[model samples]
Target: MSAASEAETRFEREDTRRRWLLSTPALLIILVAAVGPLLVVLLYSFLAPGSYGDVRWQFSSDAWFNVFLERDIFDDTLAPAWAHLSIFWRSMKLAFITTLLTLVFGFPTAYFIATRDERTREIWLFLITIPFWTNLLIRTFALQEVIRQEGLLNTLLLKLGLISQPIPMLFTDFAIGLGMTYVYLPLMVLPLYASMERIDFRIVEAGYDLYASRFGVLRRIIVPLVKPGIIAGSILVFIPSLGAYVTPRVLGGGKSMMLGNLIELQFGQGRNWPLGAALSIALMAIVMIALLFYVRNASRGGPTHG
Candidate 1:
């Protein structure tokens, strides 16, 4: 090689080496802080459950099999774990419902904030974020009070004569969905407003000038523009709502068991660490699937509107 080419190659090698050296700390942190626990859980899932809560050294696939199937003690026949299936169904249903509910409420709220003057927008955005200042558990407890019989909601209904007695609102699936929606509404709103804020109002006016009705302008112009935000916000709301523990526990009174609660039950009272590890891996897999779906859609570059 020529002297100049050799010198350039040497410089490139040193630069690459330096970059690796600089990134070593971050790589180590990720390996230890993130990958380590996941590795431990993955290992535990293949092990046998002990008589107590921990796992035995022996390898077993019972935990994984038990994820979807259970053996009936009476006839020694294997059957689908209907209880687990129902809990999984409920989790998915509630998460989807919560996403829809938040979108329904957040789209308009985001538009309102995004359309306001800069100062007013700041105030409105600040109000939207005020919920984040409080701890999640505390916020959940506060929600519990609202839907509890004889609390604000039922009391208002009673005073207004809308109901003869306080409605049985608390400790139900309705309470779970309501709590999740309230908790995740801000997540939906912030992303939507980010997308809406960048919109040019002139295009909307141009659509109107072309004799487009209010709904037409919204359907063709506004939604197409904010599609990215809708996807992001729905993902943000849905993922956490699926894995939620505290909100369901307080609101559902432990009757409405989500996947999170089920996992906890395995590790704690059920004394099935292997099953818990398997469940944890299953939850992680579901999360990865959701992320893959998001990535697939988020990477598609076709224009939402012509």
Candidate 2:
């Protein structure tokens, strides 16, 4: 080989080495922090549960079987764990509701912000992020104050003669839904706004000039264009809502428990680490399945769309 060519090859190899060296710290951190813990959890899911907070090294399938099948001690026959299934279903249902509600509300807010003048947009964006300034627990408690029996909502209703008495709102499924929506609304809006802002106004104007109605224009043009943001926001809202702990604990009154509550109970009061790990894996599987669907849909829709 020519000396010049050899020098070029040496330079290319050095550049590759430099890139890998720069990325090594992040790779190691991920391996330690994320992969390490996940592996431990996976291993625990297959191990026997200990009397205390420990796990036995002996292999067991009890944790996985406990998800759907339960053996009755009295009859020595296997039966369905309907309670666990119900909890999982409830978690999924609540997450779907939260995602749907956020999408319905967030899109309009995002569109309004996207349509604003530059300085006005900045102000609106800043307002959206104000929720992040306060601690989430404090914000959740503030929501509790607003919706409690003697709180602002009831007080206003009483003064207006809208109700004969204070409504029970603090510890219900409705309150949990409301709190989740409030907390995650910003997550949905920002991505949507980003997508909407990138859209060319001329395309919208063109649609209008072609005699498309407002609703029609939005349905066909705007919605399709911003599909990426909708998916992104839905994911941002859905995954967290499914495993939410604090919001449900504060608002759901512990009576309306979701998967996160179940997991917490297993590790804390329930003292069942193996079951908890199995449930965690199950939750992750659900998320992965959803993500797979999203990826498949995105691929089929072509590169231009989400």
**lDDT (0 to 1) per candidate:** 0.91, 0.92
The top-ranked prediction according to TM-score is 2
Cα distance off (Å), candidate 1, residue 259: 0.5
lDDT (tens digit, per residue) of candidate 2 on 20-122: 9999999999999999999999999999888987799999999999977899999889889988999999999999999999999999999999999999999
* Weakest lDDT window of 10 consecutive positions for candidate 1: 297-306
> Candidate 1: which stretches are off by over 4 Å?
1-26, 302-306
TM-score of 1: 0.90
- State every prediction's TM-score relative to the real structure: 0.90, 0.94
Supply every candidate's count of residue pairs whose N, Cα or C atoms clash at under 3 angstroms: 0, 0
- What global local distance difference test value does model 1 have? 0.91
10 residues in a row with least lDDT, candidate 2? 297-306
